[model samples]
Structures are given as C-alpha cells and as structure tokens.
Target: MKITQKDVEYIAHLARLEVDESLVDKFADQISRILQYIDKLKDADISGAGLMAGASLQNNVFREDTVKVSPGPDVTLANAPERHEDFYTVPRVVG
Candidate 1:
C-alpha cells in the first residue's frame, strides 16, 4: 500500500506521462492513499452481496412492429444524377 517514488515513476513511464520532479512525490502519496483504501476494503465482508445485471431499473422498452409506406420511386430517384427506369445508374467498374 505504501507507494514509493520508484513505483510512481514506473507508473508514469507505463502511462506515457511527462511527470515533473516536483509532482512525483505528490502522485506517490496519492497512489499510496488509494492503495491503502483498497487494503481497508479487503477486511469488509460481502458474501451476500448480489450482482447487478444492469445500471438502470428500466428494461425492454421497444416500439410495436409495423410496416410503413416509403416514398414513391419518382421521389426517391429524383436526387440521382442519372437514372434508368426505376433505378439509379452508375458507371460499371468490374472488368
């Protein structure tokens, strides 16, 4: 739980952080405190704790399945630069 200056430097190197000499001591102390809190949590009992399936209470929010009429072929093809019959026409690239 007691994070050393070397540990902080190693962590900074692994994370690709450009830590100044003045901030290394501060970061080491903060990381040590965090590890101490985790060590404290190891003593607590949670044998009966239930696992959470989701983050929210709401579930299965879905709309009814229904078919809707789309725009007519003329309206759909109106935006195309070139069209043949009811489809858009483009240059063929395959040999």
Candidate 2:
C-alpha cells in the first residue's frame, strides 16, 4: 500500500487534523513504510503455533469470602449530631 500526499491530505481532513505542508511528505513516507511492514508480517508462517486465550496465566487473585460480626448501631452512630432510635436524623429535603 503506497501512501501519497493526496492520501495523507484526505486522512488528515477525515480526522480533523491540521497537518503542516512541510510534514505531508514525511508523514506519507512513514505511513507507507508502516503499511509495507504490515504486508511483510502477513507473509509470516504461524501454522505450527498454538492459539492462546490470554497473555498471562494468572487467575482469580481474590480473597475467599468469610462471615464477620457487625459492629452494633451504638458504635456505628457515635459521631452523628442527631439520632432517632437506630438511625441518623437528617433535615427534610422535600416540601
């Protein structure tokens, strides 16, 4: 895939990029080289290679679930300025 100045201009217009006129040729050359490298990679042989589900082998890095005792409401609501029985009292928000 050969990249030309017109291709660069069209791509820049689609991406809403303001590519400088001096850098158009440089960008075209770089993009052409990248596409050529990709084409070269497409010709590589991988018929004997095994398919991989993931890059790493690590799995389930989590602690086991366990039942724990809850701190009673008295300890939980100790810092509240106003309390009603077992709940913190807040000012009414709706009229």
Candidate 3:
C-alpha cells in the first residue's frame, strides 16, 4: 500500500490537477498512510454481522396518497412577477 511520487504524479494527471512540485512528497506520504489504514480495515472480521437496510427500526414511514381537488391557476399564478392570462411570461432566451 506504499504510494510513490510517480503514483501521485500519475493520479494528478488523471484528475487534471495542477499539483505543486513541493507538495508531491507530502501528498505521497499522506496517500500511503490512507491506503495502509484501508488495508488494516479490510483485515477486520465481520462474518457474524447481518446486513440490514437501515439503522432505524421503522420502514416506509410515509403518509398514504389520496386524490384531491386542484388549487386552480389563480392561487398558482398569484405570486408570479409577470403573467400572460393563465401562463407565466419570461424574456426570450434564444434568437
């Protein structure tokens, strides 16, 4: 899991990043430590654990849908800055 200077440079090139020359060594060391930590985590035992959807006990806590009357155009267009009859008007975007 050792990260080299060349590896850092290659990663920077792939990400289209302009990594400073002075920070290459620092970045390489930090990346190496991160990879080592990940390797350590991979070695942990989790065979006894059971996979669950979420941490909470509740599932699908939503209200049931019901058909209702529409509010109509008056309430919908009341706050509009510019309206043309029942439709909203805006500046022309395309020529």
lDDT of 2 by residue, 19-41 (tens): 99999999999999999888886
Off by over 4 Å in 1: 48-54, 57-95
Q: Which candidate leads in TM-score? A: 1
Count clashes in each candidate, considering only residues at least 3 apart in sequence or on different chains: 0, 0, 0
User: Could you tell which candidate, 1 or 3, scores higher by lDDT?
Assistant: 3
Stretches of candidate 3 above 4 Å error? Answer: 46-95
Q: After superposition, how far is residue 9 of candidate 3 from its true place, in Å?
A: 0.6
**Residue-wise C-alpha lDDT for candidate 1, range 1-95, written one tens digit per residue:** 89999988998899998789999999899989999888987887979999789998987899988988989899999889999999988899788
CA RMSD of all predictions: 12.3, 13.3, 8.8
- Cα deviation of 89 in candidate 3 (Å)? 29
- C-alpha root-mean-square deviation, candidate 2: 13.3
User: What tens digits encode model 3's per-residue C-alpha lDDT throughout 1-95?
Assistant: 99999999999999999799999999999999999889986777888988897899997799769988989899999999999999999998899
User: Which ten-residue region of model 3 has the weakest summed lDDT?
Assistant: 40-49
Give the TM-score of each candidate: 0.48, 0.45, 0.46
lDDT at residue 46 of model 1 (Cα atoms): 79
